[model samples]
Target chain A: MDYDPMVMDDAESLGPVVKISQADNVRVKFELSNADLSFANSLRRVMLAEIPTIAIDLVEIEENSSVLADEFIAHRLGLIPLNAEGAESLLYSRDCDCDNYCEHCSVKLVLHAKCTGGENMSISARDLVPAGDRMHQTLGMPVIRDEDGLGPLILKLRPGQEIKLECIAKKGIAKEHAKWAPSAAIGFEYDPHNKLHHIDYWYEQDPKTEWPPSEYVDWEEPPAEGEPFDYDAVPNRFYYNVETSGPLGPDGIVTEGIKVIQQKLAGLIHELTEGEGGDNYDGPRSPEYGGGGDGFGYSTSYGGNGGNQSAWGGAGGTTPFGQTPYGGGGNTWS
Target chain B: MNAPDRFELFLLQDGEKKIVETVVNGMSNCSDFTIKKEDHTIGNLLSERLKQAPNVMMAGYKVAHPNVPELFIRVQTDGTVTPREALVNALKQLVAAYGQLGREFQKELALRQYADQGENGDGSGAQGGTY
Candidate 1:
């Protein structure tokens, strides 16, 4: 068959009903109907890998005497979910017009902790203060708190130990690194269907009754008549469950996942139909979740999509978990 | 297809506030709800499943005091819809997607199984004759 990249079909699909059974900021559940398996799988895939989240991709450690190694600390910081509320106003570092890093593309976080006396100390997310006004000015502090309203514990320090570092937070997908994943758990399953049958308790209570079975445990009151008891079977219907780690709420993750997928599909359609001039393709951009921008440009690199990072080439210890081994330095690069 | 008799299941202490004793149930713990200990399985299953709900505000479960065996499951919505309603809707979405995946798998299996037939030019699978 000739190469025809099918992004979407012309035929309209039926709309599914969304019934919320429980909800909070990070966890949620709902029942959906009329949707097909394709939609649910696509949604799961998108939720897991497509959603854009802000995470510390680059870390520069200046001084470290703490128990945890530099890379371990960096990994912990990388996994900390920043409040990505105003991320839309910022461009992907690669896409920004700046030659390298810019305020519009990245958030700089600085953490300097030291303990000189007495007992060991604790360092948490609240200590990593946002350097510039971007996140603080636009989205507020990027730290997320636990259910007890405490910041996520990043590391601990003993007396006379210190750790000073800088982190660059950027927008990226979970496919690149799970640190950017918005949800902790997301799953669904076919609903089970079963029926109950009323037992003749009066007859079954007799020891000699073989028809009703005396051995069967008798209920205090006979069950109301209804469908006969049978094995529960998986039906076409499903039960959905979602839990968020931080950043976006569970409901927000699903909504954003669907929107992100739609945008990507549209972008793909435009690319296929309009040839190589994808830059000039007029397909609609996915509206950003909270505000600021309209276009959803998929960047290939963690750096703003098209920006240069040759100066810090040696700093590229790009691994699945955030790990960068940089020689100790005191200068903060913009 | 809708699941019959969809309901919230929870195990509450005799005098404990229903919300506090359980895991994260919603944005707040003001509702008084209870369920049989036997039905705890339903909550466990659905609790694990609901984490995938779209736009979920929060998702978590608490089983504090194991000796007492009380399980708390809370699903907070983003306010786009109520918690319970979101659960039903999400399930439908999942079922739909799974169905599509099954059909695609079958189609792919059939093609792979019949690949040799197409090579023989029987017009059963892959078209031949030109590059």
Candidate 2:
């Protein structure tokens, strides 16, 4: 077998590879309300239209499956029951007119009874049986169950006739609001291909002015005659201003205030390359700093070299705040 | 010959000196004895008479003899009444005082079981008793 050395070096140059083996991240938030269609109806629509089965296959799902799967699991475990009466009430709404309960609406099943009699009993659409032959237990099955363990019993029912059950539907809107009106805007931004890249979430907040009036206006004049004028202004002039205050109505008053704010920009750039004297330039040549240019090179007649040797020497020579230095002069520069 | 209203007999063993086995049966030939509702009181009276004979051990027996009410009597080693004897005597005295109350008690128990069944009124078989 031929081993390629270049391949190994290439892999090493790429640095430590940290690949995401499993990217099954999901987040879901549910807002419940009763003014709109019942929560049971919204959930039913999600189950029937979006995802058919309550038990979703995590391996086969895409990014958005979390919303459906979360609601399914929550409903299966009886976590979010109908609460039209109160927060803790688990009754489904009885107003839905659908022959077979759909996502739109259904009745709430509060009470459950299990008989040890020979005859079978008919349960309402609100009733639920956790496990049965007619139940949508597995994935890819029909969401709505027509018979739903409701047929007549063939054999004699004896003691210990077990029936596992829960509520049939919930009552609330998809977005929780007492008035049943849904707000139009909600969104999030992320790189699906690479999750670590960036993520931004956006939601509506109380509207207000984004940018307030400037507290100061800066004014600048061109440099004067002699002494090598510093063309760049050290500090700019600022103008201060304020907006007026007024009363909106008989009981409401609005006030606007403005003030000058000082801002500072300071940073240090370290050169990685070793050098002796500022002339031995070994650092990143940024185009913005006039180091690399595609056009003709223009040299300053007065300056000794095109590089910033003089300014670098002056700044690097002195140790700030009486800090100790390791061997002064050219050796320290190296 | 008139039938004896009550019978009394002391079973004994013949020896050089006669040994009284036990006063197996003891009854007064009259119906004058008032029935006591308390079983323990009846058991105390039976124990007292049985302990009179010396070297005699009163063996326990169930009194189902005809013309006499059934009684369960126990003879203790030291003339002390056992709880079982007291209970049986109490039950016997209750039956004697209230003649047909035993049949009525059974009927009431059956009716209770029927009511506990809720809507199911089928009384075809013996209703399972709850302790």
Candidate 3:
């Protein structure tokens, strides 16, 4: 057996035997070592903005006499996290053959709450339930629940006030709207003790007190006071603490983030190889969801928006008709 | 801002060479390449990976300006393989590594009996990792 460098880049070469140190429903913590900072940052970016999740994209309110405006209520609904366990199995509405939206692409949820008594009634995510003719499993239901009925109150209804609405949940990436974000905040840090001085700290009295050292200082050796910093050092290991918003699990977010990044690279590789003439393309192009192959169909909303700003002239948005680079088997890199 | 912007980096233009080979001013086997519409994401990662190859003499990348969405990578190899081939291999390896990581995560999840979602167990809300 010959030495396979790639396979050999396992536990020993990885330099750390650490596992995901902490994990729960809404958060996950892990260490990424023997990796480049760019790779770590890229993964963090994808998890924050590219990983897809289900959210209330379109809402239709039938009756609303509550104190809150219809738009306000709808906006709150959008922030609520819906279980996105099998969101991968659902097709982007644009990719589906249906005219508007179908069961294959959209999940309909309805909220009905009325305050008929004198006491004020609270409207929460728990009040929202599956609404459809067919079977609605727990997969797409809201994940948040508490003693006070899925607490994270949307609004309070007064006596004689009522609200009735239907929500259409669709798959989308955070790049489209933050409502689809998988995590609220991704705690990413490297060189915790500033051994490399990647950043220059400002100070009036003491730099330590002014810009307090990262709590992760314990992870790295504290730079000796007044010791010369390593000018040529580059960030290699990283710490990732992902706080999910409940739409997806932290594990799901991390795994899906990797898959999305692979798809992006696969998409680019496909373009690169196809441009070089396909016969020599030996890179793996696994057909995964949203992958340029497999079931990977790039939805229009998957690209840039607002602060993200990486439109690339809209990767899947401007394609001829609705043909995505991954969806069209006949389409070339052209 | 009139900047090329981040997401615009991913959109490849027609007839545009994503990666281009340019002759170094007066060096043989030493090459400088420009990856259009990219940033440190590709430049830094690819350069770091290239440096690990025994054939690669030196590898580094830089961006001319924050506004410019171009990645400049300079690679010199020890006369065995072309810098272009080294770059392509390193890039593909990075992708493969990501795939490997995904499988490891799934394996861990499988050990935990798989899909233990909705537990929403309370207490210990403190954030912790590598501590």
- On TM-score, the leading prediction is 3
lDDT of 3 by residue, A38-156 (tens): 77888888888877778888899999998889899889989888877666666777557799987887888998888989999988888788877422365468867576557477889
Error of 2 at A197 (Å): 3.3
Q: For residue B62, what is the lDDT in candidate 1?
A: 54
Q: Residues A239-271, candidate 2, lDDT per residue (tens digit)?
A: 111110100100000000000000000000101
Which ranges in model 2 have alpha carbons more than 4 Å from their true place? A1-170, A174-196, A199-334, B1-131
Instruction: Specify the CAPRI tier of model 2.
Output: incorrect
Can you give the DockQ of every candidate in the order shown?
Answer: 0.01, 0.00, 0.21
Model 2: per-residue Cα lDDT over B1-131, one tens digit each: 78642211111112211101222244211111111111222333334323332221342334444344333444433234432233233332222211111122223323443443443455322223331
TM-score per model over all chains = 0.50, 0.13, 0.71
**In model 3, what lDDT does residue A152 have?**
70
What shift in Å separates residue A21 of candidate 3 from its native position after superposition? 2.5
Flag the better candidate by lDDT, 1 or 2.
Answer: 1
Report the lDDT tens digits of candidate 1 across residue range A273-331: 33344343232122222121223232211122111111111233121111111101211
Ranking by TM-score: 3, 1, 2
Each candidate: chain B TM-score = 0.45, 0.23, 0.76
Model 3 CA lDDT for position A123: 84
Worst 10 residues of 1 chain A by lDDT: A319-328
